[model samples]
Target: MSQPTDSSAWPPPAPRTPRHARRRKLRRAALTLVAAMAPWLAGSWGASRSSTCTPRTAHADPSFWEQVTQEPEEAARLERYQAEMQRGHQQASLVLGEGRQRDVEPLPPLQRRQLTQEARRAFQRAARIRPTVAEPHYYLAVFTFFALHSCAQCQFDPAIATEIVEELEAFEALSPLDPRLTSLLGDRAILYTRLSGHATPAKTREYLERAIADYRAIIARSAGLRQRWELTYGNLAEALMMIGDLEEAIATYRLAQRHASTASILLGLAVAMDRDERGVEARTLIRELGPDAVASWEEDVLRGDTFYVPQGEVHYYRALIAETRGDINGAIAAYRQFEQSNAHPQFAPRAAANRAALTRAVTRAVR
Candidate 1:
């Protein structure tokens, strides 16, 4: 019961045992500590967590895995959904075109509707897979619009109005706050433009304003987008014109033309200039495009010419010039004649709107 009084402490505590024994004892203690921590460490950072969290690797960066790691599972699910959507789209195109609409190569009504529904399913899956991504909601809105909200060469079903509205709301929620924070908003804007056709003034006005704001916001962030330059600006101009803001629309068209000297932008600029009471300037602008314009777009795609002449676009501009110069009847007739031969669905709505407006204006003028 007597405590050791010697400073050596009872022969140095038995020499800490043999060096080999000491090693074993130390190892045993170390193992015991590790065993105590094993479950906690495993639960927090196991093979499953590490293996499952493969970092996101962007096509632009081979080492973007770190960034993607923040949401690795979501990224994988998103990729799967995108691939599925792509597959569905390809299948839909092949089946609808080669099977039912082989005569014109355009989608038959039933086929188009079916494809849209299938696409909707894919997009819905995508939205679930990557709730953070905006593209899924955008696609959902698109498929809904195609299948339900619109019809011309393809008949639109009025029965799906509520569905379309629901999908659009979803898209809007997924949409960013500031002037279309992402390209998803751009897609949404285009979809809404179509919806704007039969919408009341209140609805149409709000949509047009949003579209214009989106375009301006996009222009402000010109650093990020380079591929869809012409399309974005051209669409913005169209949106502004729809709202009857000729000045802003013309400027936007010109701005877009500066970035990309496409015939469509030129045409839009001319129309806007004429509406702004600058018919001479508009004509000069059209003439400058020269044989760069075409008489008609043969490809059914109105994407601008690089070196080839933009004949159809020029003619459209010329007619716009006359209309801007108070020739309402002339513009209406020109649009009507062109509509009889034109096939692009994107253009039909605007062309029809212009035609209707011109007809009304003419009727009033005559009265």
Candidate 2:
């Protein structure tokens, strides 16, 4: 469940569009957004975690008969399950590609669907053989989210998304302190964040709230780990910003900066400050992060980083900054740039709308 963070409470630049119309636009944009991101997210899932299937340890005081009979049978079953899981995983790897080398062209849709269905059956069979084990459920969750349900041609099905979450929850129940749990939670959070784009206003708020909660859980669980979780911190901040919790978002972004002063983090902090009515500070931060620096980071740093801002958000923020400073022409140019780039689905509509409004204003001034 999500806390109440009504986005409507934030000031709008123009008169609010009718709710239904806005929702319709968002639903369409969300589909495009998910399609663009799903392949890479699926690739990341395959690379991040290994199967959590360990063989049962030997019985400490088993009889000779038990060792000869029951133990052998159990070992055979385990072996069968592992083999089935391996086959399914290989199928998945073929579709999702290997590690960070995700530039592999996608399999044709029909072939991909056929392979994924076969993989799903393999995982399902493995689960049936070892219903108590968590590994099969984890793989099933991954496949359901990334392969089966998240195809570029598929519509966003809320029920399927809920089922995927349930599968992940089953895995969590079976393996509470699993090393991969944090990454899985992050994945779930990302799913929720994307789902919010296609959801109704109420559902959007609820999804964002859940995302915020999951991100917080990840940060808590990752305490004392050798590597810093700056990305999680930044993600959490962004979720907070979405929910209109500007104060907490600003605080969280600053905390992320302490670990890593990334361009995304700085830009997020500036946006939060601007939304919270600290425009002077926001402008200072943007000015310090000059256009040249932003371009360099966009070209170099963001491509290598897993948790950087979406591709066009930098331009969107620039548009916002320009609008605040009364540079209408500059704002329009920035918005146009953002529209041409791989903008986030949720922000894309807003940018288009704002650009339209500014264009009208400029036209009126000319008259």
Instruction: Please report the candidate that would top lDDT against the real structure.
Output: 2
lDDT of each: 0.55, 0.69
**How do the residues 269-339 of candidate 2 rate in per-residue lDDT, one tens digit apiece?**
88777667676788688777766666765565444333323335567777866876679999999999988
- C-alpha lDDT (0 to 100) for residue 278 of candidate 2: 79
Q: In model 1, state the lDDT of residue 142.
A: 46
Off-target runs (Cα >4 Å) in candidate 2 are: 1-90, 93-113, 128-132, 143-164, 297-316, 323-326, 332-367
True-vs-predicted CA distance for residue 334, candidate 2, Å: 6.6
Query: What is the RMSD of candidate 2?
Result: 22.2
Q: What does candidate 1 score in Cα RMSD to the true structure?
A: 23.0
